[model samples]
Target: MIERLSIIGVGLIGGSLARALRAVGQVGEVVGCGRSGPNLEKAVELGVIDRFTHDPGEAVVGADVVFLAVPLGAMRGALSAIKDRLDASAVITDGGSVKGSVVADAVAAFGKVPTRLVPGHPIAGTECSGVEASFAELYRNRRVILTPLSETEPDALSLVSRMWEACGAEVTTMSVGHHDEVLAATSHLPHMLAFGLVDALARMRENDEIFRYAAGGFRDFTRIASSSPVMWRDICIANREALSAMLARFGIEMTDLAESIRRADGDHLLEIFERAKAARDRYVDRVK
Candidate 1:
């Protein structure tokens, strides 16, 4: 169990982890650190954290576990701020969506990927933000991927894995590059497409009518477009290499679909749709 857990950025992911740890009695004290006083205070009032602070260094002073849950862009600064204050035995981890860049940021901040630093990403979230959007059950049955570097200590990795497991998450490990590439294709690209589609539709001349006539399909598809723009922007930039490649591949697929429709190639369109449906169904079944 973690005697003291410090979360640098008490937003949805961080708050949910704190709540989950508390719920399972896996943590003794939860300290939240963030730039927004109001949000940190809200996290404290919501009982997601035992205390709050604007200073990252102070927050992690004696923390046995430190979770850096800030945006990817802010990772370097957050890590730097707490690097000097972290206890010798403290285990550092992050909830960044992009792992490759996060690994680089940690190295940049500390001159190396410390054995105690474990890079992680939780494959669970809602179209919500802030502490109020968090709950203890957010990670229940969810997958938390850890990307441990060559320098990562086995004990540190095991501790983080167990922590996530205690929070009801199924832990998995993979190379940082592989994690980033997979996330770029599956998670980042979809969010990017959702945001782009919504933006394009909103700018149409018949935007009002388009929205008024929209149905559940549109709502369900674009639900993730409501995510924090700044956070998504940073993710896109951080994982640009993999994301760009995925985007190019998607563009080719879209072009093919468009041409099939233009040529009235019903067979080609049907084949593509059928394949997509089968893949999605299989994924849904596996998750269930």
Candidate 2:
């Protein structure tokens, strides 16, 4: 069990982790660090953290484990703040979606990727934000991916693996490049498409009428568009190369679909639809 845990951003991800650890009685003291005083107070009131501070350095002074749960863009600043203050033996990990940028930030702050630093991403969360939206079950049965550098200590990786397991998440490891590419296709590109579709529809002349007649399909497909724009903007930029590749592939598929419709190729359209449906069905069965 972690004796002292420090979370550098007490929003959805960080607050949920704290809550999960508390529920499982795996962490001793949870200190939440954030720039927003009101949010920190709310986190304390909700029992998501034992205490909070605006200073990241102070929060990590005695922490046995530190979770940098801030946005992708804010990672460098958070890492810099706690760099000198982190205990020598402290295990440093993060919930940032993009591992390459996060590893770079850690190297910038610490002069190298410390053996104690392990880059991780928890594949969970709704279109929600802030302390109030967090819950203990957020990571339950969800996948947590770890992309540890070659310099990472085995003990550090094991500790982080166990920590996520204690939160009821299934942990897996992958290379940093592979993690970025997979997440770009599976997560980032979908969010981008959702946001772009919703935004395009909203700008149409008959937007009000269009939305008024919208159905469950539109609502479910665009649910992720409600996520924090700033966070997604940072993610898109951080993983731009991989996301661009995915977008190009998606554009090619869209062109093919459009051509099929123009040619009235019913068989081709049916083939595409059937393939997609079967892929989704297999995924659902695996999850079940």
Q: Please list the residue runs of candidate 2 whose C-alpha ends up more than 4 Å from where it truly belongs after superposition.
A: none
Per residue, candidate 2 scores C-alpha lDDT tens digits across 13-40 of 9999999999999999999999999999
Clashing pairs in 2: none
Each prediction's RMSD to truth? 0.8, 0.7
The backbone clash count of each candidate, in order, is 0, 0
Full-model lDDT, candidate 1: 0.94
Model 1, position 101, has a per-residue lDDT of 89
Residue 20 lDDT (model 2)? 95
